[model samples]
Target: MRKEIFSKKIMDWYQANHRNLPWRKTTEPYKIWLSEIILQQTRVAQGLPYYERFVGAFPDVLDLAKAPVQKVLRLWQGLGYYTRARNLHRCAKLVVRDFEGHFPNSFEGLKKLPGIGPYTAAAIASIAFREPVGVVDGNVFRVLARIFGIDKDIASDAGKKYFFSLANELLDEAHPDIFNQAVMEFGALHCLPKNPKCDGCTFSKQCEANQKDLQSLLPVKHKKLKIRTRYFYYFIVRDKNKMLLKQRNGKDIWQGLYDFYLIETSRRKKTAEVVKTDAILTKASILKESRVFRHLLSHQKLLVKFVELKLHSTKEMNLLARRSELKKFTKPEISNLPKPILIDRYLKANP
Candidate 1:
């Protein structure tokens, strides 16, 4: 297909049908970068409020850089992939300290910042800086593969290279920002992964997938994720109005988020089996036990049980805290502390 014709069709469709998102209306690199990062592994509907909240709290790069990490993570609560929030904070500081609060204007320069990969850099460069580059996200990948009929495993390095080259080849050099957005939006709205709207598509006749009836087959992605099952027994030790909570450390899931005294086991264990795992819990009074919560992540399946235990005196609470390496937090204090969604949801329902 002719690059001009292809780009023109996409841009025309975009101008008429694109959603009016706040990020699309601006040329500020900071806001653009924020939107891109939030939208990663997230849908537009889910990421929209987070973008608004982040902008409301920290309007610019310097504001984000100077704010406490806890504050950032707090604002980023309930949004999974906590690493993105951490990286967003780090990148903001790098931009402020190194680039004087101004994001790098070019793709290569933006790629130097932490968490800014090639796709993010390309997006910021084209949308904010008007660099002539195409952004190949999942949306773009599906669009290109189906429309152009290129059958390469999107997970493979060779497949990625081919699509990357094709994206640059089809890029509208004069208006890359519009072309990129148009194509991405086209795929998101029209050429869906499951049931694509092929009836009224602009490229209905030209699309290989539409003609060949293979929309689901193209854009082949082979992902081998080893889903590990984990069992968590969380002890919610409470002393009157306060509860003992511990911040997760080390390189594991929910790092830095606050949760209760946890006892992890190889498999599912009963309450008696769990109590035997920790000696500190033997001193406390077991009050209630929550039903099992089956939480699913991309690569992990967690079966969690929260056990509520009440300590008789402040001294006992202190002893539990000392032995368990936790701290006492009032109800209000616990509300302010960052927590994993599982912990937060359990608290909201139980409290």
Candidate 2:
């Protein structure tokens, strides 16, 4: 039944309706690999322009391998999940140094590269090389769970193993890319998170979830996320035209973006107290005023306080090497410098 279902309906629907993305036009393993990595945790519209910019800047593996890590981070600045950028840089260098500037063709070889996990490796192998391997992701999980009426929690280890096995069994041997894309496209377009369009769906006739009237309840997820709240006090210290800024260093969010001198508090602090704290006033002679702002992430809530200080001496703010060069520098540029979402807001407000 699965084989028949694939041979007739899904494949035909995919060929007719799949979106013509730029990545689909090429068989170049490097290009395909780059697209896959960029699209991770990024939407098609947002990722598409970055993909074009990256390909234009570094057309080949060797070009990316040789480019500075800071430049790569700058290109990837707004995308969020900065680890993807770091991994991409590392993987490119690996390909050039170890694989002769060519992306590994086989699944095993592809998996050896940094950040090439199971799904990514499968995608590169099947989409670029046409290898007979299944690419199972969230979209696939939703489609398969509803189609087969599997109630196991997708977040569980056992459930993941079961789905991968089923995906492997159902993958079409003749055209793995088309088959994989078809199921994923169906899930993305029709079988959505809310108010799914099930009436005219190709699989409606045979879909077990539809027959049982459980369209929204089949794919169970068990993971619960704990959001942590953080307090940030950023010094917008300026002497005449120059403001103080520094490159963030350490293993935390916004690993390679530029930010002002920061003071993290245990909880939200009052405005008068925020300005009076030793961390805030030690570097500046006078504080004109302070502005309070808040920024939110998927798992974080940040309360930011911006202290606008007119410094006694610009040299005290050591992060700014040359005070005269402040106007020449552009705000919010994507570089290896650490950029939290709050920094972006500050740039937009100040720019």
Candidate 3:
């Protein structure tokens, strides 16, 4: 009876005032999956266009699977977290190859796919497949914690277990899709992370945090992110019309994306010191060195320098060819190469 009342009030509120988003109109798993992936860690306003662009570029799963990884990365350039784009591409191929282009129907099957964690699986399952599981994103976490006055640290394993059980119990079994949307939308629109509208909320009388005046203290976060800084010296190796770029490989950030011949260091090195001591830079004449351009990521801060260099002889080109990472490209091909947004900014400014 309590769950039914809560769901009734939420569904009423939703009908009166839910934002008409593009994804809300579709039940197709492909579109729903794309929206969920794109909106991960991204605000709706920022991610909206990217979703539209992706849908426009790759109309279906097969199109995404067939499209070049570079094209996908290029489309995903400004959006940080290249790993998501890679997984999106990989999942598309998997769906075509393994599932015969159909998304898995069961929650257990959906969770097995790469990048389809609990929240995403629940989201796609409920919105696209009408599964009864609850979706507990940051917004949902805030709403649930405040309503129930749950002070368990959301960053902990125990808190997740508690909330997952609570969320499932609170779900409206009859209309789980509508129930899930209402709760998530309620969190987004009314029960915000900070300064939520508890006074005007319909659940105010039933809300434990409101009755106890512990709204801000309910959703506890114990973890602190350690943001490290990295110094990257990038060489814009120019042989007149041609330039050099390297595909980022290995397990580092921005893997599979194109980058300049980079020399990472523990600390910032002086331009004169690098020019005089570095083996490759000594052979090339330094055309110019740019000021420090800072690119901020969630976990790391990149202090980057774009060092423009010119080759003295055809013999000097052999040194660059010896490098496995370095590959020469004409101006047109360089434009086609999918690079990190940090490198893209330098190219645009220099061009």
Candidate 2 residues 1-351, lDDT tens each? 566675468778888888999989998999999999998866788899999999999999999999999999999989988999999999999988987998888888899889899889989999999998898888889988988899998999899989988888988978888888788888787788677788988888788888898888979888688889998887676655555676665887777667776778888877557657664255455454446676778998887877676666645544333431222133334333456667777766765
lDDT of 3 by residue, 1-351 (tens): 287777898889888889999999989999999999998998899899999999999989999999989999999889878899999999999999999999998678899998789999998988888989988888888888888788998999999888888889999877788888898889889988788898788989989888998887878988789999999988888776777788989899998999988888888898767666667677688889999999899999999898998888655765775654587788889888889998889889888
Identify the candidate with maximal TM-score.
Answer: 1
Error of 1 at 33 (Å): 0.6
Ranking by lDDT: 1, 3, 2
Better of 2 and 3 by lDDT: 3
- Please list the C-alpha lDDT of all candidates, in the order they appear: 0.92, 0.80, 0.87
Which number leads on lDDT? 1
Which pairs clash in the backbone of model 3?
Answer: none
Candidate 1 similarity to native, TM-score: 0.67
Write down the TM-score for model 3.
Answer: 0.66
Q: Give the TM-score of candidate 2.
A: 0.66
